[model samples]
Structures are given as C-alpha cells and as structure tokens.
Target: MTEEDWIAHDPDPVTAAELAALDPGERAARFAKPLTFGTAGLRGPVRGGPDSMNLAIVVRATWAVSRVLTERGLGGSTVVVGRDARHGSVPFAIAAAEVFAAQGFSVITWDHPVPTPVVAFAVRHTGAAAGVQITASHNPRTDNGYKVYFDGGLQIISPTDREIEAAITTAPPADQIPRRPVHPADDTLIDAYVTRAAMVRRGDHGNPRVALTALHGVGGELAMRTLRTAGFGDVHTVASQFAPDPDFPTVAFPNPEEPGAADALLQLADEIGADIAIALDPDADRCAVGIPTPDGWRMLSGDETGWLLGDYILSTLDATDAATSVVANSVVSSTLLGKIAADYGARHVVTLTGFKWLARADAELTGFRLVYAYEEAIGHCVDPAAVRDKDGISAAVLACDLVAHSGAQGISITDALDRLALRHGVHTTAALSRRVADAVEAAAMMDRLRADPPAELAGFPVGATVDGDAVFLTGGDQQTTVRVVVRPSGTEPKVKCYTEVGLAVGADLAKIRERAAAVQQQLLATAQSW
Candidate 1:
C-alpha cells in the first residue's frame, strides 16, 4: 500500500491531513520504514505514518495484542489501559481499548491520566491478561509510546515481544478494525496502590520538609497525595511544573537527569529550606533525588540513591536470615551494592539494563526474596511485590522516610554517604552516549569495539573484554577495579558507554573521584573516535 492508502484508512482527520500535506520526499521518508517493536514497545514522534506513533499504529498494535492473546487461549481475558497527559495519548489509549473490546476482550480504562506504574499494578490487581500504558516516559513532549505488561505486571520480554511484532505485521488496517465502548477502570486499584505505597515506610518517622516536581507531566496530584498519606505533610511541589502540560514548557527535556531539568525544584527546595527534594519523570515510573549539603544543595546520582536505599533496606532486614533476602542492580550500576549486601549477609544479583530484568531477580533465583532492586538511570523498584515496576511515588515516600529517620539521628544524607564510603570503597560511575544517524552506524560501532578492543583506558591497562549486545572492558589489577561497558540503547537511536572506577575506602575520595572523572572522559573520547 502507498501513502495515499494509509491516509485513506486513517481514522484521525488531523493525522490524515498532516500526511496529505507532506511532499513526495517527505512522504517516502515517513513510510519507508516501519516502526519496530522491541522490549520497550512502540515509541516515536506522534505523526501519521507507519514509522510514527499515530491512531492507526496504536489500533493495529492493539489488534495484534488481541490476536496474540487469543492465540495463547486468552481471547475473552480482561485488558487494562491507561495514558499520560501527552499529545494524542488520550485518543490513542481510547483507540487501543476500542480495539481490545472489538476483539471480544473485556477492557478497563482510566478516566484521567495516571502514572504508568498504576496501570501496571492494575493489571496484577485485577488479574488482567494484559495492560497497556500510553506514555513517552522522559522523552521529549513531541514523542509518545505504548508499553505492554503481561499477567505478572512485568513488561513483556523475549519471545513475547517478537510474537507481538509478528502479529502486528498481519493485522487489519485501521478503518477495518472494529471498535467498542470502553469500561471505566476500577478506582479501587488507585486507592489500593496508595495504601500499599504508604506501607513501605518502616515507622512513623516525622515529616521532613520536602520539595517535589512532576516535570510538567501527570504525577503531581498522585505523588502529593501518596506523600501526605505516608505522614509527610510538609511537601512542597514546584508550582510551575506541578500541572500536566504536554508541552513541558518549564524544561528543555522532561527527564530529571538532564542538566538543569530539576532547577526549579532545587530553587524551591532552597526557598523552603527543604530537607530533601525529589523529581519524577513524565510517566512517574522513575525518580531523581536531591538533598541539602553543607555548601549548598545537590542532586544524588542514581547509584548513590540506589546504594542508600539498598543499605537501609538490608540493614532493617533480619540479618540472621540474610541468605533469603536478595538485592539487585544492573550490570552497569555501581558494584557497591554487592559489598553492602555481603556485609549484611544478603545476596546480590546483576542483570541486563531495565527494570524488566531487575524486577524479576527473585523469580530467576532459586529461593531468595527480592527486597529491593534499582538501576543507575534513576529507576527504583522498592516494592516489587506490589507493583513489579519502577514507581516514583513509592520511591519518594521511602526516600522521605529515610531522610526523616536520618534527621532524627542528627545526620544528613551526605553524612550517611560518608559513612558508607568509610565502610565500603569509594565507587564512582559515569556515562557517555552518542546519537547516531541510524541503526546501521550503531551496529558498526559495537562490532568494531568488540573485534578490536581497547588496550587501555586512561592510564590503566585493559584487563579483559567480554562481548554481547554490549561490550565490556575491564581494567585494574587484583586490588582495585575499573570497567566500561559500551552498547547501543535499546529504546533510542544512540550508543551509550558506562564507566566505573573503584578506590580503596581510605583513599582521599575527592581526589580519587576527580581522577576517575578524568579517566571517564578519556574513555569516552576514545569510544567516540571509534
């Protein structure tokens, strides 16, 4: 079929008109390649093309999901759907529900925008066969996406993702796809999530002055309510970014990890003398934290937050039975968590990037219970048993509880970090990423790195190289450690390199960190050149 055929079948007039206005060259570019669905699901700019995220794409994707479910003997199963406040998200979500309903499946949908984790929780809470969340996560406002969760409320992996894509290829067109009214989602699920989130707190730690921001997405109201319910009544939200604005006017990008993205929240923290600050991504599935330091206020790296939370949870567990308690981080995350777990006699597991793997650490292990899991990209799964996904609201509440407890003991978050360093080695981490024109270039880069690995990084001799979808270069002798993992991002068109350096606990941490930063820069420069 040609572009005209696609436009003819499009249900949304706005997208159809946009496609009709494009020139011949532009039209070919738009339809030349079909969007590929992977572990992250379908995501791209909101445009009228097979390559973009439009009504037709969503309808077809939903139809494919329905077919896949039926083929697996779940034809009449319940499917839950939810959306963020992104452009075209509501209509796209509704379209998905309509497709599901048309396929003889029961559909449940949220009336208002909610966090992605809520939808994931609803899938498990209601025993639905599948769930879909319309969001772009921390991507730019111009982008939108579809994320799928299976029966266990975990994102689909491996054969499932591939099977859905195959079904999409043979699905009917948008106009031919059937539609039906969607049922209202159960509000009880939301209440249940809030209650479960509040329970994550260990004790009645007094409320600490906290500043929070939603980054102009849909997490504002829910986050505030959850905090207040968790005994944190002194929460202050960034006024400019509290509301769900699709354009995200306050920041160049909605991701809290981006430079200056959390400026407004930091400023608010200083103004209110907040003991801690938190920023949630657009979908509220990831969290970024900031704390007051002696010189000023600074945001904690994802690794730092992961270490703190992992340590706190492990410390509270019954050490006598640490073998049954497990903590996990990604392959690229800091190795300090392993040391902390060992100190507390708990087990530690490492997996590939993404919570889809981290959340299932327990299931993969023989007889261990996953107490906590985190990745270095500000994604934390504090209560995997309840949500089984990264939940910013729950993480924020837990962070606040930690802060309140630390304050009561006359120590700050920084003080806790110092103590951690004193016990374990000072571990530092850095990341380097490069955007490429296309996937071909990314593949070539990875292939080249694996075939001819770097002999050395900075002044350290390269110890070993392991190859996979990502390539790992290890450095240092038997005493210290340095590592760099280079790979293409699964969800975006970029190649990312992760680097880490470990120093003995007694070394001057400041100077060691500075040297590590220099080494990271050198490694990044070499990788970029390749």
Candidate 2:
C-alpha cells in the first residue's frame, strides 16, 4: 500500500478536518497514517501534508502534546523547543512553539541550533512537562522529524506515547488546536545549554591539535566550545561545514557513520597533521572519532568508541562511590566493557538496543548507577546526572579525556584497546541490513521466518530460535554454532540482522580478526537470503 492507503481510511473524525484543510495530493499523502507520537515521537520524510512533519504536522503534534498536558491539569504547562540543522528543522521547531503557545502552553525555545540530546536535557532541567526537537537523526537530507520527551528528560515510551498518539488521533481539527498569545520559548535555553556543557573537563589535556567537523550539521559550535572548555587549544574546524546549513550541503545524510561523511575532516586532518578528528552528525547526538594511526587516519567503530569511553569513565570515577553495575544496550560491543567491569568488580547488564530501553530499565532503582551507556550505532548517554538521554557532548569530552589520560600514561587510545583485547580474548561482531520495499513486506518476512525457522543456518547447526512479533533469532554460542538475530528497523524501512562470533584467540588478534571476517561474510550471506 502507498502512503495514501494509510490515510484513505481514517477512522477518527478529527482526521477528516485535517484532510479538508489540505490540497488534493497533500490530503491523500497525509491520510496515509497521521504521524503518531511514538516512543521517540514522530520521524519521517518531511513532506506528507498534515500527517508528515511539515509546518502543519509540527503544529498539530505540538497542539496535541499541549492538549494532553492541559487536560491533565497543566493547561499552562511549559515546554522546551529545540532544533538541529536539518532541512526545515528550524521552521518545524518554531511551528511547534507557535502551536504550544496557541494552546496556552508556555514554551521556551532555543534561539540557535542545538543537539537533540541537549533539548532532552533542557526538558528535564527546566522542569517542563515536555520537550520537542526537530530532527530526523541520521536519515537522509530529504527527511525531517519531531521528537518528544517526558518530564524526566527521556523519550516518551510505551503507553505514554500511545496515550498521546490516541489524543492526537482523536483530537479536533488541526486549525482548532490551541495556541497561546505570546512566544513562550524565551530563547535563553541555548545559552544555558552552552554554559552547562562548558563545565565538563577533559582532565589535564591542554593545547592539543584536534580536528573537528560537523558533517554539515549544527554540532560545530557546541563541539568547539566543549573542546575549549576541556582545555584543548589549537583546534582546527573543517571549512566546508563549520556552520549550520539546513540542506546539509556537504554530506548526503549528515550521519558520521555513513561512508564519506567524514571525508572532509579526514582530508583536513591529513593536511594539518592533527592528532585526531572528531565528527558529529546533523543532530550531533551521535559522534565519530578518527585517529591518525600508523595505517593513516582510521575512523573507530561505535563499539571501539564505546569501550574507550566506558573504560575511561569507570577508571576516572572512584570505585567506592561508583555504582556496582554498568548498563549497555544489547547490540553494543561488550567484550572490552565486560572485561573492564570485571576488573573493576562491577556487574554489567545488557538491555535491548536503543536509548529508550536503557532509560526505562530503571537501572537506578535496581542499584545500577548508569554511570555510562552506549549502543553500537555511535549513540552514547553519559552524565546521567545531567541528561537521561544520550548526549554526544559528554561522550566527546570523555573521549578527549581518555586520549589525554592515555597520553599521560605514555600510551595511546589504540594501545588501550589493544590491552583490552589482550585481556578479553578479542570478540568481534557485524550487522547486516536488507532493505524491504515496505514495512508490510518486512513484517510478512519476519512472520514467515517465525513459522518455519531452519534447523541449520549456512551449514551451521542451529542451537535454538527466538521468535517474536518483530524479530527472530536462530542460534546460540557453541562449537560450530553461529548466532544471528533478525529484527525490523524500528524507525526505517530495513530489516537488520546482527551476527556475532566469539573466538578465543589468546592474544593472536590477527587470527581472531581473520576468522571473524570469514564468519561475518557467511552470516551476512545467510541473512541476505532471508
């Protein structure tokens, strides 16, 4: 079914009014499925009439959010609005503010561009009932999105998003959603965020040559300020994308993980002989690091970065005061961290992939301090005291600190990784993705796999299979038994298959890598067939 199919059969009367206000093509497009506030709020292509994240969609989403707060006796509740440097992000943010104001909800808007993590932090720090950020994260330039956070400063999840979506789905006409008389977003939130972030330190690292790139997004200023605050000097900003450009002119998706997104920085690093290169995506919540290794400027994987940050933070904090348990997403590389925590005498817990899962697992209640958290997708949530959401700013600072500390110890961050690998026996992982024509197709494929899982995958005997509504996992770690987990992308049109191979190489890292490469290819081919 097309986008029109989702909206063609709108069951709610409130949806009809939104349809009437749109032009013919727009009405058909939006009627597909009104963007509902999911656990992470609305995110999609920016052009689907009222249902999509156009000016109209932003207005309606804000109105719906404000309406929910008002109905819960917070009619004049305050909300914070922030936006990244994506196409139409600023306009969508402003539109969200206007709708909140029109609904008599107080709105505090950021004047300048900011990261989504900071917006989440602001919602918690300002004591606001909700927050809105306009960004599609790592998606391509053609897309934009809206994200909402709960009062505790994390993304709304489960029944909460469902409840808000229900209200939005059954609300009055789009034009009828309430608005206040004045702009409530004082625009001072930006300054507050800047000041707050500038307080984090990078230990004794001072006056180091660091190359920074924003990937044509809005992270440059924040990253520069952060480095300066951490006592780094002689920082070089890559010229092509030093400022905010909604079009993301320099990169295809503004995601640092995407191929070639960091090419400019890599070139700049080579020209300037910089020590390391740091890249932030459009929204800046995710960061990538490239170091000038003997092999030239090599970008580190999300797992490597996570290991460095987690180890550095745990080592820095006093063991006596630190929580006894550390939490990480299930898909993250935990080999190094597992070893680190074991040496530190801390328990390591793994939750389902995603920040939403980490935030809701109540690690704190369970005696887990949540000192640090990360996923394999370059997302990190550090400084639980500052923001329950993932903040690349803190993670970046931590990385700088790790580098500085390693330097102080007469070593390099890479050396530290080598040490961890030596200690942990070297674990390797890989993820493969297959794009489907539609979500229905993806779901149907998942259903079929659940119904008839193979006893063997790629000539390897299957240990067991996990069959869930959204995914299927068909293996366990054993001799000649491989592990593969298949799940549909929660926010995009792709089926992701994760494979892991654990080989105890006993300090023979090269052999481990070669075997892991062969296993990755075999698992990938098997996954593609599904």
Candidate 3:
C-alpha cells in the first residue's frame, strides 16, 4: 500500500500521526519494501511502515496465521499468544490474540509479559493449534518481532513459512480486519512450566554458589525461582540486570554472547566467590556460561558449553538405550558432540543452523530419540520432550546441576572441561561476521567466496569446498582438522564465517588454543580480503 493509504487505514492513531508528520522522501523509504516472512518469523525495528513491525503488521500477520490454520482444517482451534518485556510487545500480542479470536479461533493471551519459552511450553501444555510470541529475543530496544510455532510447539519451517507469507500478502487492510475480545489468559500454564522445569534435575548434588544475570529481560524472576525449586538454593543474581528493562540500561546489546554483555555477572560471581556464572539472553531462549580460572573470570564460548552439556547429558543415559539415543547440533557447531555421542554408542546428527531444525531432529529420524540438541549460538535444548525449543532457563538449571555434581566429587566445572578436552581433543571455534550496506553486497560477497575459494587457510591446505545455503571449506590431514563455513545472516545484511580447528588431546591445551586463535585471525582476515 502507498504511504498515504497506510496512513489512512492504520488502526493506531499515534502511528498514523507519526507517518503523516514524515516528509515525502521519508515516507517513501518507509514503504519502499514489505517485510519478508522467513523461518525466524517477522523481526525488525518498531515503526510506522509496512517494512517495520507495527500494530497493522501484527494484525495482518495474525490474520494470515488464522487463515492458514483454517485452511489446514484447524478452524476454531486454540491459539496461544505471549509476549516479552520489550516496547510494543504487549500491545502487539493483544492485537494478535484479538485477530485470532475474531477469526473464530480460541485464543489464549498472557496476562503479563513472559519469556518466549513460556509460550512454547503453553502451546503443548494446552494442545493449541499454534503459538505466537511477540518479541525480538536479544535484539536492541528499538526492535520487535512475531514468532510462530506450529502444533507440536516447534517453529514453522519450509512451506509453512511460505504459505503464511502468501496469506499475509492477500490479507486485508487494518481497518477492515476484524478483532474480538480474547479470553482471559490461564495463569496455571506458568505453574505447569515451573513444574516441568524442575523435573530436569536428575539428582541431588553438592550445593555450589552461583550467580545469574537476565540481561534486563523478563526471565529473571522465573529463572531464579525455578533454580531454587530444583534444589540449587545458593544463587545470586546481578542486581543491575535483574529487572526487566526495555532500554536494557546496563548493556549496549542485550545478547549474552556479545562482548562485555556478561561482565556484570562475572564481577558479581567473583565478589560472591561463586563457583560459576550464567547469563541468559533477553528472552531467555539462549544461555551463556562463565567460570573462574587462574587467570581470572572467563566466559565459556557457546561451543565449549555445548560440548560440556552434551557430554554431561550423554553420560547419564543407560547403555542399553545408547543405540536409540541421539544428540544433535547445528552444522556450524563444533563436531566434538558427534564424537562424544559416538563414544557412548549413540548417533549424532548435524542439522542446519537453527533450533527450528535441532528441535525437530527426533521426529525426522526413525526409531531414535533426541536426548539433547544445541547450536553454536548459545542455544540448547536439554529437555526436548518438555519444551521443544532452545530454553535458556532449563539449560541454566542443567548447568547448575552439572556444577553441583562436579563440586561434590571435588572437581570444578573448569576441571571437568579440562578432562573433556583431554578425552575429546581441543576444539576451538570462532565466528567472523561483517555487516554489509545491503543484501546485494552480502550476496556479492558470498558469490565471490564461492567463485574463488581460498586455496589455504592459516597454514593448512584447503582440501574441499562444498556449497549449500552456505559455502564450506575443509582442510588439514588426519593428524589435525580445520573447517570454515561462510554464509549470509538469515535475518540481517551481513556475511558470517564460522571456523573450527581441532588438535589432539594432551597437556598443552593453552598453547594449542593460542595457536588456534592465531590461525582463526588469519582465516578471518583472508575471508575479509576476498
């Protein structure tokens, strides 16, 4: 629709006035392109335009989802809607719930802002046809999003995403779209989630001092309560980041994986003499862990945490079930999990880069059950049966459990990691991401890499180049192995390179890591020059 038409039909008077105040050029830019619906769902800055996330867009998306559900013979089915503490999240969620209600679907709306995983769990707990979460996860304060989950509480993928996009294109204007009063949200769902989260604890172990930070998101209270209820009573949360703040006052970026994001939590851990520190992303769907080393406090990379958690979970399973047991990680994640799985006589599957794939790994494989799944981006699915998504809260609980178990046996998490390195080798991973001016530039960079691939990276000879959604390069011989995968960010105008180097397990882990870090820097520079 034209800018004038959008202004005329916008349901929110405030947004309409904002658009009316804009100059012609600004208005044109706002409507220059429509927001594309992809596997991650709709995410962008919150503003008054077809390309931005606003009340009108939420209404249209909800209408499209209602149509798709009805077309799939799910008319009048239950649809659960939830939101986080970000700006405009509550209104957008209410608007979505109203749209579903107007379409003759039973809508369940949260009474207050909650974590994204709560909505995912509620979808299955209530047997809803689909679920919608109004959040941007760890995006900046100015951003918002709409995430959709299908019947099994899994995010929509493939043809489902495309079908919803088509429906959105044909949706009516905001003024013509109808809305109805939604039913009061059932608060019991949160209780049910707490109950299930508590069940993730396997046994009683030593009580290790812990520190946590929610990064100014909505997951703090729930996460802390769940941990205490699960028998980990000694826990302290970073005061500055405990409350839900849309502005994320303490950090420039709310993501735990970002530089300096977990600094506050680390300092807090040290001050309290805590055994470990845990940081959860804004929406609590991803987790980042930190430990105290002789050098000082250090945050563990996503791969390191993944391997630790993957191995810990694998060790708890029975040998008789190993044949049917499975552990999965993304293709870009470290391959150490696969080796760990193999050692236990279990299978490991490498999927595309996203929890959407990892969450459904069990269903895709016949006769095998997914015991654990993780991605390189601090996402872990510790209990897929309860919540079929990357749940930071549950993962945090499991990490605490591991810390307690290790402490009881006179070993710290650091000691356990060192032992794992001795058994599985030192697998160092790093990511190089560059923001481009536009999608054209990102695609051009990808094309350039594919057409003239690097002959060698660091000092290792580049052996093979494989192409898919991304381009991957493999190097080194049987003694040592290195891998580089380059691809464009699915949600942003950027190209990302993931590199991993493997060295034999031995006593010189620090030296091996230093060498690997130097090689990673060289590989990143080489990719950038290309």
Q: Which prediction has the highest TM-score against the true structure?
A: 3
- Per residue, candidate 3 scores C-alpha lDDT tens digits across 1-530 of 66788899999898899999999898888888888875559998898989889999999999999999999999999999999989899889889999999999988887788888888899988899999999999887899999999957999897888999999889999978999978677678898898788778879986778899999999999998889889888999999999999999999989998889999999999999998899999899999999988889999889989998988888888998888988999988899998899899999999888888888887867899988999988999999888889999999999989888888888877788778777888778888788898778988988887888877888789865655669988888665788988888776667888889887755678887777677777877877776
- Give the Cα-based TM-score of candidate 1 against the true structure: 0.96
Off by over 4 Å in 3: 464-466
lDDT of 2 by residue, 1-530 (tens): 23343344333334444655668765664555566654388877766454556665676567668767887787877788888877778667777887887777777886667888778878878888888888887787787888888757888777768777777666654555554444445546656666666555546754557888877777788788777766776689888888877687878767787778889999898999887788887788887888878778988888788877877777766777455556565543444566677777766666666787766545456656777777777888767667887777767776766676777778877788778777765656667778898778998988887877767765666754554434544443553336677788777787877776655655567777787678768878877888
Better of 1 and 2 by lDDT: 1
lDDT per residue for candidate 1 within 364-387, as digits (tens), equals 678778889999999998988888
Q: Where does model 1 exceed 4 Å of error?
A: 507-511, 524-528
Q: Residue 320 CA error for candidate 3 (Å)?
A: 1.6
Q: What do the candidate models score in CA lDDT, each in turn?
A: 0.88, 0.72, 0.88
Ranking by TM-score: 3, 1, 2
Clashes of each: 0, 15, 0
Candidate numbers sorted by lDDT from highest down: 1, 3, 2
**Residue 140 displacement in candidate 3 (angstroms):** 1.4
